[model samples]
Target: MTGDAEPASDERTPGRRRLARTVLTGAAALGAGLVSGPGPAPTATGSAGAASSDATRRRPAGPDTALRELAEGNRRWRTLHERHPDETSTVRRALLGGQHPFAVVLGCVDSRVPPELVFDQGLGDLLTVRSAGEVLDEAVLGSIAYGVLELDIPLVVVLGHQSCGAVSAAVHADLTGTELPAHMQYLVDRIRPAIDPKLRGDARVDAAITANVLLVRALLAAEPELAARIAAGRLAVVGARYELGTQWVHRIG
Candidate 1:
């Protein structure tokens, strides 16, 4: 991770190439016969099948492909047409060799809004990071950077949701000036600035949730590690909000 004050605009192309090689080596070792399952037996070294699968999977998804896949998957989810791709033993075995997930989702730590479920993607398909209110922190930023910079994931989605408890709490605190507990207060403090002081109740919380997603998206787009990729058209950062009742995710930003 680079300094938060400015984008790390130094020449990263050569370094990215080096990192790709390193990841290939590390992935091979990590994937060999380490997976636990009732499925296919593991070979002493990895099977040729896994290698082939890895090769096919390693083709980096472009931003448009990534977005289209997610939108199609979400449609399946909301329509109860989910195919639940990639959960099979074969897919798991292939993943033992390496993961080439297409997107990075920075979403709330809310139970109802699991990224995999919302997008209807299976294992090894997404690199997901979560926090209450999707707050930005060093760890979260580093995780996202690893996916975009190392894994070469092309899409990053900042996922917010309706009736978010974190944003609701922040709205409550802002309206009444009632301080939350120390740790929870940390989440509120991070979220408070995104809320509109004039809006009240549900409207305030709903607007704040969308604002928070945009805020995180902006922060990511400005990040040195990610910004260069965006400029080169190698990566995209988007904002979306999930409706719990309809089980649909709508692009908000």
Candidate 2:
């Protein structure tokens, strides 16, 4: 969750070794492959083992309590502390056929803004979608709806970040008539309406980021399936911003 890289295998403790073995065996049966599309099957236990091993090392708790845990984990990350718990093989093997992630996050496509790292979560913990400016386009909305209705994820986070380049571009285009390419301009066009004309300078950027987060939250809450779940008190949506310099997230609502 801290966005820190995984520790070396030699550094792993005895408990971690046992867990890794379990995850690997399961991955073998499931025909686990890399993040990329399916390729050749794992050749040896060592290869298959690496997949589950990595997964076990990163696996987090169920979705029901994931958000609260994420907030707590972020605090630990900011404090430069490590709990260093190991995910057991039993748990890893059991989860091969199914997973129940707790929360869904709509974040920006910025490479530096990975939600798992910022929130200090591991694999299988968050259902994540990334789009430039965290914009609410049809595809993005559909993805969120799928997570809510099909996955039954309990919480949705609209994560905008500080000093977002996408928001800045939109602001610049609004100030000057300089035309952007049709495809790139589409992104600006979506973000432009979220900008508060009353605000200018740095405040303009900040307000635009916050407004976009709110707008996305509203859009998700208004989706028929998502809206019903929210009204029934079965789901919640919130907004936040990740500060690049500080490597921390501040909740906006």
Candidate topping TM-score: 1
Write the residue-wise lDDT of candidate 2 on 1-253 in tens digits. Answer: 2233322222111110012211112112211211111123323333345445544454333332455566655544444442322234554665687776677899999998987777656556678999999988788888888887898877788888878889899988988866798788888888886777777687777778777776666666667786676566677676666766555565544
Cα lDDT tens digits for candidate 1, 102-131: 999999999999999998787899999999
Candidate 1 vs. true structure, TM-score: 0.76
lDDT of 1: 0.71
Off by over 4 Å in 2: 1-64, 82-92
Whole-model Cα lDDT of every candidate shown, in order? 0.71, 0.63
Q: For candidate 2, what is the TM-score?
A: 0.71
TM-score of each: 0.76, 0.71
Clashing pairs in 1: 7-224, 8-224, 31-96
Candidate 1 has its poorest 10 consecutive residues by lDDT at 10-19
Best by lDDT: 1
